[model samples]
Target: MGQQSDGDAAVGSSTEFQIRQSFQNKEEVVLSVKDYSIRQGIEYRVLESDHLKYHRKCKEFDKGCSWLIRISLHARKGTWEVRRYNGPHTCLATSISSDHRQLDYYVICARIYSLVRADAAVTIKVLQEATEANYGFRPSYKKVWMEKQKAIAQIYENWEESYAELPRWMLGVQSTMAGTVTVLKTSPIHLGDQVDESTVYFHRLFWTFLPCIEAFRHCKPLVSIDDTHLYGKYGGTLLLAIVQDGNSNILPIAFALVERENAESWSFFLSNL
Candidate 1:
Protein backbone atom coordinates (compact mmCIF):
# COMPACT_ATOMS: atom_id res chain seq x y z
CA MET A 1 0.00 0.00 0.00
CA GLY A 2 1.11 3.54 -0.71
CA GLN A 3 1.83 6.00 2.08
CA GLN A 4 -1.12 8.25 3.04
CA SER A 5 -1.19 11.96 3.66
CA ASP A 6 -1.64 13.03 7.28
CA GLY A 7 -4.78 14.94 6.37
CA ASP A 8 -6.94 14.80 3.28
CA ALA A 9 -7.11 18.04 1.32
CA ALA A 10 -10.50 19.76 1.04
CA VAL A 11 -12.36 19.03 -2.18
CA GLY A 12 -13.14 21.74 -4.82
CA SER A 13 -10.39 23.98 -3.46
CA SER A 14 -7.33 21.79 -3.91
CA THR A 15 -6.32 22.28 -7.54
CA GLU A 16 -2.85 20.68 -7.33
CA PHE A 17 -2.06 17.01 -6.87
CA GLN A 18 1.10 15.03 -6.12
CA ILE A 19 1.92 11.33 -6.30
CA ARG A 20 0.97 9.43 -3.11
CA GLN A 21 -1.38 12.16 -1.84
CA SER A 22 -4.40 10.35 -0.41
CA PHE A 23 -8.17 10.90 -0.30
CA GLN A 24 -10.81 9.43 2.01
CA ASN A 25 -12.47 7.51 -0.80
CA LYS A 26 -12.89 7.24 -4.56
CA GLU A 27 -15.73 9.79 -4.58
CA GLU A 28 -13.50 12.41 -3.01
CA VAL A 29 -10.84 11.87 -5.67
CA VAL A 30 -13.37 12.24 -8.47
CA LEU A 31 -14.89 15.41 -6.95
CA SER A 32 -11.47 16.99 -6.50
CA VAL A 33 -10.55 16.23 -10.12
CA LYS A 34 -13.81 17.66 -11.40
CA ASP A 35 -13.37 20.83 -9.37
CA TYR A 36 -9.86 21.24 -10.73
CA SER A 37 -11.01 20.75 -14.29
CA ILE A 38 -13.80 23.30 -13.91
CA ARG A 39 -11.51 25.82 -12.26
CA GLN A 40 -8.92 25.55 -15.03
CA GLY A 41 -11.60 25.56 -17.75
CA ILE A 42 -10.07 22.38 -19.15
CA GLU A 43 -11.80 19.19 -20.20
CA TYR A 44 -10.54 15.74 -19.34
CA ARG A 45 -11.49 12.31 -20.65
CA VAL A 46 -11.92 9.46 -18.26
CA LEU A 47 -9.65 6.59 -19.36
CA GLU A 48 -10.79 4.16 -16.66
CA SER A 49 -12.90 4.12 -13.49
CA ASP A 50 -13.99 1.36 -11.17
CA HIS A 51 -14.21 0.41 -7.50
CA LEU A 52 -10.45 0.16 -7.23
CA LYS A 53 -9.00 2.70 -9.62
CA TYR A 54 -9.71 5.94 -11.51
CA HIS A 55 -7.66 7.21 -14.47
CA ARG A 56 -8.13 10.28 -16.62
CA LYS A 57 -6.19 12.22 -19.24
CA CYS A 58 -6.49 15.65 -20.80
CA LYS A 59 -8.98 15.76 -23.68
CA GLU A 60 -6.23 17.06 -25.93
CA PHE A 61 -3.68 14.58 -24.67
CA ASP A 62 -3.03 13.18 -28.17
CA LYS A 63 -2.74 16.67 -29.62
CA GLY A 64 -0.08 17.91 -27.18
CA CYS A 65 -1.25 18.28 -23.56
CA SER A 66 0.61 15.85 -21.29
CA TRP A 67 -1.78 16.27 -18.29
CA LEU A 68 -2.99 13.01 -16.81
CA ILE A 69 -3.67 11.42 -13.42
CA ARG A 70 -4.29 7.95 -12.01
CA ILE A 71 -5.76 7.31 -8.58
CA SER A 72 -6.10 3.88 -7.00
CA LEU A 73 -7.42 2.57 -3.74
CA HIS A 74 -4.79 1.44 -1.24
CA ALA A 75 -6.79 -1.30 0.47
CA ARG A 76 -4.35 -1.90 3.30
CA LYS A 77 -4.16 1.81 4.14
CA GLY A 78 -7.91 2.38 3.62
CA THR A 79 -7.30 5.40 1.38
CA TRP A 80 -7.28 6.33 -2.29
CA GLU A 81 -3.86 7.49 -3.39
CA VAL A 82 -2.68 9.26 -6.50
CA ARG A 83 -0.22 6.87 -8.13
CA ARG A 84 0.67 8.94 -11.20
CA TYR A 85 0.22 12.63 -12.08
CA ASN A 86 1.61 14.91 -14.77
CA GLY A 87 1.70 18.68 -14.18
CA PRO A 88 -0.84 21.36 -15.22
CA HIS A 89 -2.45 21.34 -18.65
CA THR A 90 -0.21 22.40 -21.55
CA CYS A 91 -3.02 22.62 -24.14
CA LEU A 92 -5.27 25.62 -24.80
CA ALA A 93 -8.54 25.78 -22.86
CA THR A 94 -11.25 24.06 -24.89
CA SER A 95 -14.41 25.20 -23.05
CA ILE A 96 -15.50 28.84 -23.05
CA SER A 97 -19.16 28.48 -22.21
CA SER A 98 -21.24 29.76 -19.29
CA ASP A 99 -21.59 26.20 -17.99
CA HIS A 100 -19.24 23.26 -17.55
CA ARG A 101 -19.99 19.61 -18.21
CA GLN A 102 -18.04 18.53 -15.12
CA LEU A 103 -19.91 20.92 -12.80
CA ASP A 104 -23.02 18.86 -12.20
CA TYR A 105 -25.72 19.16 -9.55
CA TYR A 106 -23.80 17.04 -7.05
CA VAL A 107 -20.83 19.38 -7.21
CA ILE A 108 -23.07 22.42 -6.85
CA CYS A 109 -24.87 20.78 -3.93
CA ALA A 110 -21.65 20.48 -1.96
CA ARG A 111 -20.87 24.15 -2.54
CA ILE A 112 -24.34 25.35 -1.46
CA TYR A 113 -25.17 22.94 1.39
CA SER A 114 -23.93 25.37 4.04
CA LEU A 115 -25.97 28.21 2.60
CA VAL A 116 -29.08 26.07 2.54
CA ARG A 117 -28.56 24.96 6.14
CA ALA A 118 -28.30 28.55 7.32
CA ASP A 119 -31.43 29.63 5.46
CA ALA A 120 -33.86 27.08 4.09
CA ALA A 121 -35.59 29.79 2.02
CA VAL A 122 -32.44 30.78 0.15
CA THR A 123 -33.34 31.50 -3.48
CA ILE A 124 -31.85 29.87 -6.55
CA LYS A 125 -30.76 33.22 -7.96
CA VAL A 126 -28.63 33.80 -4.87
CA LEU A 127 -27.11 30.34 -5.26
CA GLN A 128 -26.37 30.99 -8.90
CA GLU A 129 -24.59 34.24 -8.03
CA ALA A 130 -22.57 32.48 -5.35
CA THR A 131 -21.53 29.77 -7.80
CA GLU A 132 -20.53 32.26 -10.46
CA ALA A 133 -18.46 34.24 -7.95
CA ASN A 134 -16.63 31.12 -6.82
CA TYR A 135 -16.25 29.19 -10.12
CA GLY A 136 -16.47 31.94 -12.76
CA PHE A 137 -19.34 30.25 -14.61
CA ARG A 138 -23.10 30.71 -14.45
CA PRO A 139 -24.99 27.43 -14.35
CA SER A 140 -28.50 27.22 -15.77
CA TYR A 141 -31.47 28.25 -13.63
CA LYS A 142 -32.84 24.70 -13.66
CA LYS A 143 -29.53 23.27 -12.55
CA VAL A 144 -29.29 25.67 -9.60
CA TRP A 145 -32.89 25.01 -8.57
CA MET A 146 -32.30 21.26 -8.69
CA GLU A 147 -29.11 21.61 -6.66
CA LYS A 148 -30.93 23.73 -4.05
CA GLN A 149 -33.49 20.99 -3.62
CA LYS A 150 -30.68 18.46 -3.24
CA ALA A 151 -29.07 20.72 -0.65
CA ILE A 152 -32.36 20.98 1.26
CA ALA A 153 -32.62 17.19 1.31
CA GLN A 154 -29.13 17.00 2.76
CA ILE A 155 -29.78 19.68 5.41
CA TYR A 156 -33.17 18.39 6.45
CA GLU A 157 -33.93 14.70 6.13
CA ASN A 158 -35.01 13.47 2.69
CA TRP A 159 -38.73 13.38 1.86
CA GLU A 160 -39.09 9.59 2.16
CA GLU A 161 -37.32 9.46 5.50
CA SER A 162 -39.33 12.41 6.82
CA TYR A 163 -42.58 10.64 5.91
CA ALA A 164 -41.37 7.37 7.45
CA GLU A 165 -40.60 9.10 10.74
CA LEU A 166 -43.91 10.98 11.02
CA PRO A 167 -45.63 8.47 13.25
CA ARG A 168 -42.68 8.28 15.62
CA TRP A 169 -42.42 12.05 15.74
CA MET A 170 -46.13 12.38 16.49
CA LEU A 171 -45.86 9.86 19.29
CA GLY A 172 -42.90 11.67 20.81
CA VAL A 173 -44.65 15.02 20.65
CA GLN A 174 -47.80 13.69 22.33
CA SER A 175 -45.84 11.92 25.02
CA THR A 176 -43.68 14.93 25.83
CA MET A 177 -46.47 17.53 25.74
CA ALA A 178 -49.62 16.66 27.60
CA GLY A 179 -52.97 17.58 25.94
CA THR A 180 -51.34 17.67 22.49
CA VAL A 181 -53.54 16.13 19.77
CA THR A 182 -52.28 14.16 16.77
CA VAL A 183 -54.25 12.16 14.22
CA LEU A 184 -52.49 10.11 11.55
CA LYS A 185 -54.28 8.63 8.56
CA THR A 186 -52.73 5.94 6.39
CA SER A 187 -53.77 4.11 3.23
CA PRO A 188 -53.11 0.56 2.08
CA ILE A 189 -49.86 0.08 0.17
CA HIS A 190 -50.16 -1.10 -3.43
CA LEU A 191 -47.67 -3.40 -5.07
CA GLY A 192 -48.21 -3.06 -8.84
CA ASP A 193 -51.53 -4.76 -9.52
CA GLN A 194 -52.02 -6.16 -6.03
CA VAL A 195 -52.89 -4.35 -2.80
CA ASP A 196 -50.62 -5.07 0.18
CA GLU A 197 -53.04 -5.28 3.12
CA SER A 198 -50.22 -6.00 5.54
CA THR A 199 -48.48 -2.66 4.86
CA VAL A 200 -49.80 0.89 4.84
CA TYR A 201 -48.45 4.26 3.70
CA PHE A 202 -48.88 7.74 5.11
CA HIS A 203 -51.83 9.68 3.64
CA ARG A 204 -52.51 12.57 5.98
CA LEU A 205 -51.64 13.94 9.42
CA PHE A 206 -53.42 16.48 11.70
CA TRP A 207 -51.79 17.93 14.77
CA THR A 208 -52.24 20.77 17.27
CA PHE A 209 -50.23 21.65 20.35
CA LEU A 210 -51.81 22.01 23.83
CA PRO A 211 -50.94 25.70 24.10
CA CYS A 212 -52.45 26.55 20.73
CA ILE A 213 -55.66 24.64 21.50
CA GLU A 214 -55.98 26.24 24.95
CA ALA A 215 -55.28 29.70 23.57
CA PHE A 216 -58.04 29.35 21.02
CA ARG A 217 -60.65 29.26 23.83
CA HIS A 218 -59.99 32.91 24.71
CA CYS A 219 -59.88 34.03 21.06
CA LYS A 220 -62.89 35.09 18.94
CA PRO A 221 -65.48 32.53 17.96
CA LEU A 222 -64.67 32.96 14.27
CA VAL A 223 -62.06 30.61 12.72
CA SER A 224 -60.37 30.87 9.33
CA ILE A 225 -58.76 28.02 7.42
CA ASP A 226 -56.39 28.07 4.47
CA ASP A 227 -54.01 25.75 2.64
CA THR A 228 -50.82 26.00 0.61
CA HIS A 229 -49.28 23.51 -1.82
CA LEU A 230 -46.22 21.49 -0.88
CA TYR A 231 -43.68 21.35 -3.71
CA GLY A 232 -41.39 18.56 -2.56
CA LYS A 233 -40.77 15.10 -4.00
CA TYR A 234 -44.38 14.19 -3.17
CA GLY A 235 -47.07 16.76 -3.87
CA GLY A 236 -49.43 17.65 -1.00
CA THR A 237 -51.23 20.53 0.70
CA LEU A 238 -50.59 22.06 4.12
CA LEU A 239 -53.81 23.08 5.87
CA LEU A 240 -53.83 25.63 8.67
CA ALA A 241 -56.53 26.98 11.00
CA ILE A 242 -56.22 30.39 12.61
CA VAL A 243 -58.28 32.48 15.05
CA GLN A 244 -58.18 36.14 15.87
CA ASP A 245 -58.06 37.59 19.37
CA GLY A 246 -59.90 40.71 20.55
CA ASN A 247 -56.82 42.76 19.72
CA SER A 248 -56.91 41.44 16.13
CA ASN A 249 -53.86 39.26 16.70
CA ILE A 250 -53.96 36.08 14.65
CA LEU A 251 -53.02 32.72 16.20
CA PRO A 252 -52.69 29.37 14.47
CA ILE A 253 -54.62 26.64 16.25
CA ALA A 254 -54.29 23.61 13.99
CA PHE A 255 -52.25 22.25 11.09
CA ALA A 256 -52.56 19.28 8.73
CA LEU A 257 -50.89 17.78 5.68
CA VAL A 258 -53.27 16.34 3.12
CA GLU A 259 -53.09 15.12 -0.46
CA ARG A 260 -54.81 18.15 -1.94
CA GLU A 261 -57.31 20.95 -1.45
CA ASN A 262 -60.80 19.57 -2.00
CA ALA A 263 -64.16 19.14 -0.30
CA GLU A 264 -63.10 15.93 1.48
CA SER A 265 -59.76 17.39 2.59
CA TRP A 266 -61.39 20.60 3.80
CA SER A 267 -64.03 18.58 5.64
CA PHE A 268 -61.34 16.53 7.35
CA PHE A 269 -59.38 19.61 8.46
CA LEU A 270 -62.50 21.49 9.62
CA SER A 271 -63.88 18.46 11.47
CA ASN A 272 -60.59 18.07 13.29
CA LEU A 273 -60.21 21.81 13.95
Candidate 2:
Protein backbone atom coordinates (compact mmCIF):
# COMPACT_ATOMS: atom_id res chain seq x y z
CA MET A 1 0.00 0.00 0.00
CA GLY A 2 2.90 2.36 0.73
CA GLN A 3 4.51 1.69 -2.69
CA GLN A 4 1.13 2.23 -4.39
CA SER A 5 0.77 5.56 -2.64
CA ASP A 6 4.28 6.64 -3.79
CA GLY A 7 3.44 5.65 -7.36
CA ASP A 8 0.21 7.65 -7.22
CA ALA A 9 2.11 10.63 -5.84
CA ALA A 10 4.69 10.41 -8.61
CA VAL A 11 1.96 10.33 -11.25
CA GLY A 12 -0.05 13.16 -9.66
CA SER A 13 2.92 15.49 -9.21
CA SER A 14 3.64 16.37 -12.84
CA THR A 15 5.93 19.31 -12.00
CA GLU A 16 8.18 17.09 -9.89
CA PHE A 17 8.31 14.30 -12.53
CA GLN A 18 10.55 15.48 -15.34
CA ILE A 19 11.53 13.42 -18.42
CA ARG A 20 14.35 15.47 -19.95
CA GLN A 21 15.57 12.93 -22.48
CA SER A 22 17.28 13.72 -25.79
CA PHE A 23 17.00 12.01 -29.15
CA GLN A 24 18.86 12.49 -32.40
CA ASN A 25 15.70 12.89 -34.45
CA LYS A 26 11.94 12.46 -34.31
CA GLU A 27 12.10 8.95 -35.80
CA GLU A 28 14.65 7.91 -33.19
CA VAL A 29 12.51 9.36 -30.43
CA VAL A 30 9.42 7.53 -31.65
CA LEU A 31 11.23 4.22 -32.15
CA SER A 32 12.97 4.43 -28.79
CA VAL A 33 9.76 5.33 -27.00
CA LYS A 34 7.91 2.53 -28.71
CA ASP A 35 10.52 0.06 -27.48
CA TYR A 36 10.28 1.51 -24.00
CA SER A 37 6.50 1.29 -24.08
CA ILE A 38 6.61 -2.34 -25.16
CA ARG A 39 9.19 -3.34 -22.55
CA GLN A 40 7.24 -1.62 -19.78
CA GLY A 41 3.91 -2.97 -21.02
CA ILE A 42 2.56 0.48 -21.77
CA GLU A 43 0.20 0.92 -24.73
CA TYR A 44 0.43 4.22 -26.54
CA ARG A 45 -0.12 5.75 -29.98
CA VAL A 46 1.21 8.72 -31.85
CA LEU A 47 -1.35 11.49 -31.55
CA GLU A 48 0.59 13.91 -33.75
CA SER A 49 3.93 14.01 -35.57
CA ASP A 50 5.51 16.69 -37.74
CA HIS A 51 8.86 18.21 -38.58
CA LEU A 52 8.93 20.33 -35.46
CA LYS A 53 7.21 18.21 -32.80
CA TYR A 54 5.59 14.88 -31.84
CA HIS A 55 2.72 14.07 -29.47
CA ARG A 56 1.80 10.63 -28.14
CA LYS A 57 -1.06 9.47 -25.92
CA CYS A 58 -2.08 6.34 -24.09
CA LYS A 59 -3.82 3.85 -26.36
CA GLU A 60 -6.80 3.93 -23.94
CA PHE A 61 -7.45 7.57 -24.72
CA ASP A 62 -11.17 6.95 -25.16
CA LYS A 63 -11.21 5.41 -21.67
CA GLY A 64 -10.07 8.77 -20.21
CA CYS A 65 -6.39 7.75 -19.95
CA SER A 66 -4.49 11.00 -19.43
CA TRP A 67 -1.02 9.48 -19.97
CA LEU A 68 0.68 11.59 -22.65
CA ILE A 69 4.12 12.62 -23.86
CA ARG A 70 5.19 15.55 -26.04
CA ILE A 71 8.53 16.00 -27.76
CA SER A 72 9.87 18.89 -29.82
CA LEU A 73 13.02 19.70 -31.70
CA HIS A 74 15.48 21.88 -29.84
CA ALA A 75 16.92 24.28 -32.42
CA ARG A 76 19.98 25.22 -30.44
CA LYS A 77 20.92 21.66 -29.44
CA GLY A 78 19.86 20.13 -32.75
CA THR A 79 18.13 17.33 -30.85
CA TRP A 80 14.64 16.27 -29.96
CA GLU A 81 13.78 16.96 -26.34
CA VAL A 82 10.95 15.56 -24.25
CA ARG A 83 8.93 18.67 -23.39
CA ARG A 84 6.12 17.04 -21.39
CA TYR A 85 5.04 13.64 -20.02
CA ASN A 86 1.81 13.03 -18.09
CA GLY A 87 2.64 9.71 -16.49
CA PRO A 88 0.80 6.75 -14.89
CA HIS A 89 -1.06 4.61 -17.38
CA THR A 90 -4.71 4.03 -16.49
CA CYS A 91 -5.23 0.73 -18.33
CA LEU A 92 -3.49 -2.63 -18.18
CA ALA A 93 -1.07 -3.56 -21.01
CA THR A 94 0.08 -7.19 -21.06
CA SER A 95 1.17 -7.71 -24.67
CA ILE A 96 2.13 -5.95 -27.87
CA SER A 97 -0.49 -6.35 -30.59
CA SER A 98 -0.02 -6.57 -34.38
CA ASP A 99 -1.38 -3.06 -34.66
CA HIS A 100 1.97 -1.85 -33.33
CA ARG A 101 4.39 -0.45 -35.95
CA GLN A 102 7.50 -1.56 -34.05
CA LEU A 103 7.76 -4.62 -36.29
CA ASP A 104 7.63 -2.54 -39.47
CA TYR A 105 10.46 -3.08 -41.96
CA TYR A 106 12.14 0.27 -41.35
CA VAL A 107 11.98 -0.07 -37.58
CA ILE A 108 13.28 -3.65 -37.53
CA CYS A 109 16.13 -2.69 -39.84
CA ALA A 110 17.09 0.24 -37.65
CA ARG A 111 17.01 -2.01 -34.58
CA ILE A 112 18.93 -5.06 -35.78
CA TYR A 113 21.04 -3.95 -38.76
CA SER A 114 24.25 -3.61 -36.77
CA LEU A 115 23.81 -7.09 -35.32
CA VAL A 116 23.03 -8.49 -38.79
CA ARG A 117 26.07 -6.80 -40.32
CA ALA A 118 28.33 -8.01 -37.53
CA ASP A 119 27.17 -11.58 -38.11
CA ALA A 120 25.96 -11.96 -41.67
CA ALA A 121 25.10 -15.62 -41.05
CA VAL A 122 22.60 -14.81 -38.27
CA THR A 123 19.37 -16.63 -39.04
CA ILE A 124 15.88 -15.13 -39.13
CA LYS A 125 14.81 -17.24 -36.16
CA VAL A 126 17.62 -15.81 -34.06
CA LEU A 127 16.69 -12.27 -35.07
CA GLN A 128 13.03 -12.93 -34.27
CA GLU A 129 13.90 -14.21 -30.81
CA ALA A 130 16.23 -11.26 -30.20
CA THR A 131 13.48 -8.82 -31.12
CA GLU A 132 11.04 -10.57 -28.79
CA ALA A 133 13.52 -10.43 -25.94
CA ASN A 134 14.49 -6.81 -26.49
CA TYR A 135 11.17 -5.22 -27.41
CA GLY A 136 8.52 -7.75 -26.31
CA PHE A 137 7.43 -8.65 -29.83
CA ARG A 138 8.21 -11.37 -32.35
CA PRO A 139 7.90 -10.58 -36.07
CA SER A 140 7.02 -13.10 -38.75
CA TYR A 141 9.72 -14.77 -40.80
CA LYS A 142 8.62 -12.95 -43.93
CA LYS A 143 8.80 -9.55 -42.22
CA VAL A 144 12.26 -10.33 -40.86
CA TRP A 145 13.39 -11.50 -44.30
CA MET A 146 12.07 -8.34 -45.94
CA GLU A 147 13.69 -6.13 -43.31
CA LYS A 148 17.03 -7.92 -43.78
CA GLN A 149 16.90 -7.30 -47.50
CA LYS A 150 16.10 -3.65 -46.89
CA ALA A 151 19.10 -3.36 -44.56
CA ILE A 152 21.38 -5.01 -47.11
CA ALA A 153 20.08 -2.69 -49.84
CA GLN A 154 20.82 0.35 -47.68
CA ILE A 155 24.38 -0.92 -47.07
CA TYR A 156 25.03 -1.50 -50.75
CA GLU A 157 23.55 1.87 -51.66
CA ASN A 158 26.09 3.54 -49.37
CA TRP A 159 28.86 1.54 -51.07
CA GLU A 160 27.56 2.54 -54.52
CA GLU A 161 27.69 6.21 -53.54
CA SER A 162 31.39 5.75 -52.71
CA TYR A 163 32.02 4.86 -56.35
CA ALA A 164 30.72 8.27 -57.41
CA GLU A 165 33.53 9.91 -55.43
CA LEU A 166 36.22 7.73 -57.05
CA PRO A 167 37.59 10.60 -59.12
CA ARG A 168 38.30 12.76 -56.10
CA TRP A 169 39.43 9.69 -54.14
CA MET A 170 41.97 8.84 -56.85
CA LEU A 171 43.18 12.43 -56.81
CA GLY A 172 43.82 12.17 -53.09
CA VAL A 173 45.55 8.83 -53.55
CA GLN A 174 47.76 10.34 -56.28
CA SER A 175 48.61 13.24 -54.00
CA THR A 176 49.60 10.91 -51.17
CA MET A 177 51.59 8.57 -53.41
CA ALA A 178 52.91 10.83 -56.17
CA GLY A 179 53.13 9.12 -59.62
CA THR A 180 51.87 5.89 -58.02
CA VAL A 181 48.16 6.01 -58.88
CA THR A 182 46.40 5.93 -62.25
CA VAL A 183 42.66 6.25 -63.01
CA LEU A 184 40.87 6.13 -66.35
CA LYS A 185 37.26 6.57 -67.45
CA THR A 186 35.80 6.32 -70.96
CA SER A 187 32.38 7.19 -72.38
CA PRO A 188 30.44 6.30 -75.50
CA ILE A 189 30.35 8.69 -78.47
CA HIS A 190 27.29 10.78 -79.28
CA LEU A 191 26.19 10.51 -82.92
CA GLY A 192 23.11 12.78 -82.93
CA ASP A 193 22.17 16.44 -82.23
CA GLN A 194 22.35 18.58 -79.05
CA VAL A 195 19.52 16.85 -77.21
CA ASP A 196 20.85 13.37 -78.01
CA GLU A 197 24.31 14.41 -76.78
CA SER A 198 22.99 13.76 -73.27
CA THR A 199 22.80 10.08 -74.18
CA VAL A 200 26.58 9.78 -74.06
CA TYR A 201 27.34 7.40 -71.18
CA PHE A 202 30.25 6.06 -69.18
CA HIS A 203 31.44 2.71 -70.51
CA ARG A 204 34.37 1.59 -68.38
CA LEU A 205 36.61 2.57 -65.47
CA PHE A 206 40.17 1.37 -64.66
CA TRP A 207 42.54 2.13 -61.81
CA THR A 208 46.01 0.97 -60.71
CA PHE A 209 48.56 2.06 -58.17
CA LEU A 210 52.29 2.15 -59.13
CA PRO A 211 53.37 0.46 -55.88
CA CYS A 212 51.46 -2.69 -56.78
CA ILE A 213 52.88 -2.59 -60.30
CA GLU A 214 56.49 -2.18 -59.05
CA ALA A 215 55.97 -4.81 -56.34
CA PHE A 216 54.84 -7.35 -58.92
CA ARG A 217 57.93 -6.59 -61.06
CA HIS A 218 60.27 -7.72 -58.26
CA CYS A 219 58.01 -10.64 -57.15
CA LYS A 220 57.64 -12.84 -60.24
CA PRO A 221 57.59 -12.75 -64.01
CA LEU A 222 54.26 -14.61 -63.93
CA VAL A 223 50.98 -12.67 -63.92
CA SER A 224 47.47 -13.99 -63.21
CA ILE A 225 44.34 -12.23 -64.49
CA ASP A 226 40.73 -12.91 -63.67
CA ASP A 227 37.29 -11.38 -63.82
CA THR A 228 34.27 -11.70 -61.55
CA HIS A 229 30.64 -10.62 -61.74
CA LEU A 230 29.64 -7.68 -59.52
CA TYR A 231 26.21 -8.20 -57.90
CA GLY A 232 25.44 -4.52 -57.31
CA LYS A 233 22.35 -2.66 -58.53
CA TYR A 234 24.20 -1.73 -61.73
CA GLY A 235 25.59 -5.16 -62.56
CA GLY A 236 29.05 -5.25 -64.13
CA THR A 237 32.29 -7.29 -64.29
CA LEU A 238 35.41 -6.69 -62.20
CA LEU A 239 38.68 -7.51 -64.01
CA LEU A 240 41.77 -7.92 -61.88
CA ALA A 241 45.49 -8.44 -62.42
CA ILE A 242 47.52 -10.11 -59.71
CA VAL A 243 50.91 -11.78 -59.15
CA GLN A 244 52.33 -14.19 -56.57
CA ASP A 245 55.48 -13.19 -54.73
CA GLY A 246 58.40 -15.48 -53.74
CA ASN A 247 56.70 -16.03 -50.39
CA SER A 248 53.49 -17.00 -52.25
CA ASN A 249 51.63 -13.85 -51.22
CA ILE A 250 49.03 -12.74 -53.76
CA LEU A 251 49.66 -9.10 -54.73
CA PRO A 252 46.99 -7.26 -56.64
CA ILE A 253 48.20 -4.91 -59.38
CA ALA A 254 45.15 -3.33 -61.06
CA PHE A 255 41.41 -3.56 -61.43
CA ALA A 256 38.82 -2.45 -63.95
CA LEU A 257 35.04 -2.37 -64.29
CA VAL A 258 33.45 -3.31 -67.62
CA GLU A 259 29.92 -3.85 -68.85
CA ARG A 260 30.25 -7.56 -69.68
CA GLU A 261 32.68 -10.43 -70.17
CA ASN A 262 32.64 -10.12 -74.00
CA ALA A 263 35.68 -9.95 -76.25
CA GLU A 264 35.42 -6.16 -76.60
CA SER A 265 35.29 -5.70 -72.82
CA TRP A 266 38.22 -8.13 -72.40
CA SER A 267 40.20 -6.19 -74.96
CA PHE A 268 39.47 -2.87 -73.26
CA PHE A 269 40.57 -4.33 -69.91
CA LEU A 270 43.77 -5.84 -71.39
CA SER A 271 44.63 -2.58 -73.17
CA ASN A 272 44.47 -0.74 -69.83
CA LEU A 273 46.62 -3.44 -68.20
Q: Pick the candidate with the highest lDDT.
A: 1
Off by over 4 Å in 1: 1-9, 12-14, 189-196
Q: Candidate 2, residues 141-194: lDDT per residue as tens digits?
A: 988877766665555444556566667777888889876656456564656643
lDDT of each: 0.85, 0.69
What candidate 2 gets wrong by more than 4 Å, as runs, is 1-17, 20-28, 41-43, 64-66, 73-81, 88-90, 94-100, 112-133, 136-163, 188-195, 198-200
Reference-based TM-score of each model: 0.85, 0.69
Give the winner by TM-score. 1
What is the TM-score (0 to 1) of candidate 1? 0.85
Candidate 1 steric clashes? 0
Instruction: Give the TM-score comparing model 2 with the true structure, all chains together.
Output: 0.69
Steric overlap count per candidate: 0, 0
